[model samples]
Target: MVVARTRTTCVLGALLGGALLVSGCGDDSSDDAFSGQKADDIAAKAVAATDKASSVHMKGTAKVKGASTVGLDIRVDDQGNCTGTISGDGARAQLLRSKGGDVLIKGDRAFWTNSARAGGGDAKQGEQLAGKLAGKWVTAPADGPDAAFCDKKRFLASMDQDKTERQGMKRGTETEVDGEDALTLEKEQEGNRISMHVATEGEPYILKAATAGSEDSTMTFDDYGEKVKVQPPSQDEIVDPADTQA
Candidate 1:
């Protein structure tokens, strides 16, 4: 859950900003299916479709408040299974969440060292913890703080509509996202420009959301309804925190 707050602000804010803007017509209109539709309507449809998705793969880069850019590549399902990699602050880790709510993380040396120091350990202790935990799958209980990153429910809830943010919105020129036909929606708020691309040929799911100015961010969504497959790490690869003195 390292980038959880940042992800919510960057990704969910893009979604809400795009959805909240007042509807307007675009400059050019072709015979595309969504050309005649209202921007708000299209945005609403996209939001609804995304809300109903059984699963999705999200990839993006966002700046954390006290950290440099963070990168995410996560595939998660409604059943709470997820697998992904998170990289930030010169550290990277692979994470897996089982359907039964278990979370396992295998991080590089830098990641372990950073975590150790962040938890108030001294340099020597950080290095020792890294030596023992680096590249080892560490199990986290379902109710633990680490499990917050694996909660698909919280992820989606961040995108829920916020009426107060609604302002002026307009449709942009039709575009393509990841080889799929999409309609662009644009909005601006507090010096930030927000854009959302919604698929036009299918279920109108939001394919991408981007924000620029002050803080730049981008999140893309795909693999709708795909199954999230994950398995717990073997005992040999797992490092229980209770067993570690660090």
Candidate 2:
């Protein structure tokens, strides 16, 4: 049950507070309204900027509910390799060791060998269990600021499917995240509300996201549009001999 999660951007509450403040009036209302509107605009720009950059690099934490999620951390490479660890509860740790169909997930006690040739009850059981867990994962352009994930563009462009109305809150003014000025956008959907912070310098942009729905997940972006060094995974990181039978 290795859940294949499509990567997403960061939407920090702090950043969204400022951008969501522009849509109202009065001393506090005015401030809040302006923040919301500004955040929307900033997020859009950040997406555009991040799209334009040659690469991006980032890291963050995620908390998920409904499914088993204690803490999960992952990284993506421009060449299409997504690798990381999942630790908590009885499972301990799970590692993503490949891209797409070649993927592998190793739990602290056992591992999944994802080759098409592998077959068995444990394999099927592992896949089913992994699929039921809910948690957040981080993503950035594999190449740093100058590059972007090709699939990501399509995902963000399709925000209509999951659009939710925003909850009524006092939107804060635009603010800086880690150093970059960002605007945040907040909207409610289903039982959860999402806030996003967007910013950009040309194609190198930053977008952060936070959700308060059934699951709590937060993600951040850094050097999204700037090209940064990405190292190749060592051979050992790609496969586990213990999971493979000779």
Candidate 3:
């Protein structure tokens, strides 16, 4: 949220930050034999844990070819509900979908069409259409070509199954993220890399997955199991494509 003129500071993803520290205790997992686990086992376990969580808070930066870079902030619920904003290059868009698959898009005109069109990727085309779509809401189809980005739960839940894209995964380091005990696992293929920050102290959740120099973009995960409720915009605000003045 950006603060308008008056005098106030907006907040974005504020959280308690601290590394998970291991104290002297019976399990003393700091020295546990996790080192003996196979790379495949670790990778598989991380994937399994992430899938099981079925929900999370995600935020990150992703490079968009014609759009420069975009910042993504999203929350996904177990029932496949997702809500978030993707903003960059002076443009921003709000997106949401219910568990039933109805999609709603609000904000930047360029963003709405780019996401709602099956063949929409022309940068020039987006701007032109955006001019005509001011103050309009797009009710997109569930299976639209661009719906993938709007449906985080469905996309990420199957990340572990991308065996062909992930390779040579090896443990990197034992650390903490957002105050949780975490272990790093990394894999690279064809110059694309995915580094997973897997929680080690509890249920082995994939706390975060960061990708740099990849077509997939960089993203982070947190606040697993947090409730994320989305309310649809009011009816009159929606702009039917057929009824548009443009």
Give the candidates in order of TM-score, highest first.
1, 3, 2
Instruction: Give the clashing residue pairs of candidate 1, or none.
Output: 21-169, 22-168, 22-169
Writing each residue's lDDT as its tens digit, candidate 1 over 1-246 gives 011242322111211111111122223345466767676667667776877888988888775455567677889888879999877777888879887566787888888777766666688887898898888888877665565456766665545535333335577767888899887777776687778788888698878877777657788889999888887777788888779973
Q: Lowest summed lDDT over 10 consecutive residues: which window, candidate 1?
A: 11-20
Question: What TM-score does candidate 2 reach?
Answer: 0.49
Q: Tell me the tens digit of each residue's lDDT in model 2 across 146-243.
A: 11222234323332222222223223456667877654455554575556655533342545656666656655656553333324345555543333
Candidate 3 segments whose C-alpha is farther than 4 A from its true place? 1-35, 64-67, 88-90, 112-128, 157-161, 187-194, 212-217
Clashes of each: 3, 58, 0
Question: Residue by residue across 87-178, what tens digits does model 3's lDDT show?
Answer: 75455767787884766666666454453342334666556666766456666666663344455545453343335444456667788888
What is the overall TM-score of model 1 with all chains considered together?
Answer: 0.80
Quote the lDDT for 73 in model 2. 45
Alpha-carbon RMSD, candidate 3: 10.5
Quality of model 2 by C-alpha lDDT: 0.37
Model 3, position 73, has a per-residue lDDT of: 85
TM-scores for the candidates: 0.80, 0.49, 0.71
Q: Report the Cα lDDT for candidate 1.
A: 0.67
Which residue pairs show collisions in model 3? none
